[model samples]
Target: MSAQSLRHQLLTADKPGRADLLFGYLRAHGNKHYEEEGTQMQHALQCAALATRGRESATLVAAALFHDIGHMLADDPVEANNPTLKDDLHEELGANYLKGIFPEAVLQPIQLHVAAKRYLCTLKPAYYEQLSEASQKSFRLQGGPMSEQEIAAFEQHPFHKAAVKLRGWDDQAKDVNVEHLEIDAFRASVLEALS
Candidate 1:
């Protein structure tokens, strides 16, 4: 199917259909390895599973699932191997692409997830130390943590806490061996959050 048609379908699809399209997309493009993790799809599933296990709202769980989808849009060979090789700003890209399909509750976390990473680096001195090597590299490209002023501004956003939580999930989602729900498992939650 064409890109336009897929977008329209994703935006207009019922819960199950939308989930299918998302799954198809991930199955096709999500094959790319994400740093040390197995693949992009694996990471997404792990993130969503983490949110589910944490008993987060559907919006946050969906946000966790789609957070890095922007990366799927690009076929950057170097980036697939070296995260710091490129900064595609996947957060903004994914949020913009998903805006028409989901509500602010879902979109905001995807948009701010990167900022959440930067914010965490600022709030916890040891936080930066815990990041994976690929994460550490991307952290530099993402502005190498936030300044105090930036941190204050980030914390003031309505979804600030949620985004931070999502970021934590994002970081932990890299474990390849973790058993988690697949994309289709979020069908009900995705349907509810659709705009």
Candidate 2:
């Protein structure tokens, strides 16, 4: 992608107006995350800020903030007997999107969040147990229930630590107030630079 186009996607836009626009644009009934009990945009902000609280780097923080940005455009069903993250894995989508717009530092955390999820499910028994049913089910579909060997191998991956941290913050971020940051600020920052 060109520099300008890459520059554009990194921009965040999810507060009030952008949130509504995102909902209108991305939240169709068939869409899974739209009616998934929490606002998708709110979820993203919480995840991002949560990571920041852990003294995580800004890239990881940004990754947390926009971790599920792709899900805003995800294809999930709201009321299905079997909930699935079967659509495009938001991690890859969000990571690729980040790659186009941000540095590898940012893209790495996003790309690895799912792996982080899988890794956590393996090492932390209670941790995996704590996941929402939808989240737990996702681990299976997303290559969860990893074997001992798989877990051992995963530990060696470069981003494994960051991914794990991202996962923790991602889960702990389920707060109403944490979503308070203005996406417009991040959006304006990126847009202003490009403009």
Candidate 3:
């Protein structure tokens, strides 16, 4: 579907239709690579699977599945992997788009996942080295490690811990060999997250 139609669906569709549109959109355009070892669809499914396996809340599982959706929603989705491009602020874009559709339980983690990465890099120095080369490059574009003040504020967010967990899943979700459940597996979680 065209971006215009997708936006229209997101904006005007009923709850169930929104969920269907989301999964359909993912299935369609999610084959695009975004600096990960696997396709965007694979990464999303893997992260959601990790969240499901960990017994996280349904909202959180949905958040994990849709966290990087901002990449897909971008005017140029491939810009995420372009070292020369600036930070796309995809977290904010996604959270903003999803505002009316989902509750904060789902949006907060998506919004803070990037900050969670920055938080992790500071809280655990070794985490920086564990990042993929593309992630490392984006880390620089994403402002590297968080400052002391930033860390302090990040910790105060209600979803900080969830965001941190989502970040861990995000980091590990790039495995090309991992077989993940299909998007249909997350339908319930996605529907539950819908406002």
Among these predictions, the greatest TM-score belongs to: 3
With candidate 1 superimposed using the best TM-score fit, by how many Å does residue 20's alpha carbon deviate from the native?
2.1
TM-score of 3: 0.90
lDDT of 2: 0.58
Candidate RMSDs in order: 4.5, 7.6, 4.0
Question: Could you tell me every candidate's TM-score relative to the true structure?
Answer: 0.89, 0.67, 0.90
lDDT tens digits by residue: candidate 3, 1-195: 655556556779987899988898788778988876799999999999999999999999999999988887675554334343344688987777677888999999999999999899888879989998998899888998888899999999999999999999999999998877889999988988788
The residue pairs found clashing in candidate 2 are: 31-76, 32-76, 32-77, 48-64, 48-65
Sorting all predicted structures by lDDT, with the top scorer first, yields: 3, 1, 2
Give per-residue CA lDDT, model 1, range 82-139, as digits (tens).
3332445788877876767889999999999989988988788688899999998998
Question: Across residues 1-195, which tens digit of lDDT does each residue of candidate 2 receive?
Answer: 222232232345423333333323323321234434557666665675566557666667656666675564344232111122233777876565444455666667677788878877777799988887778777888987677887877788777787788888777665555435655434432322221
Residue pairs with colliding backbones in model 3 are: none
Give the clashing pairs for model 1. Answer: none
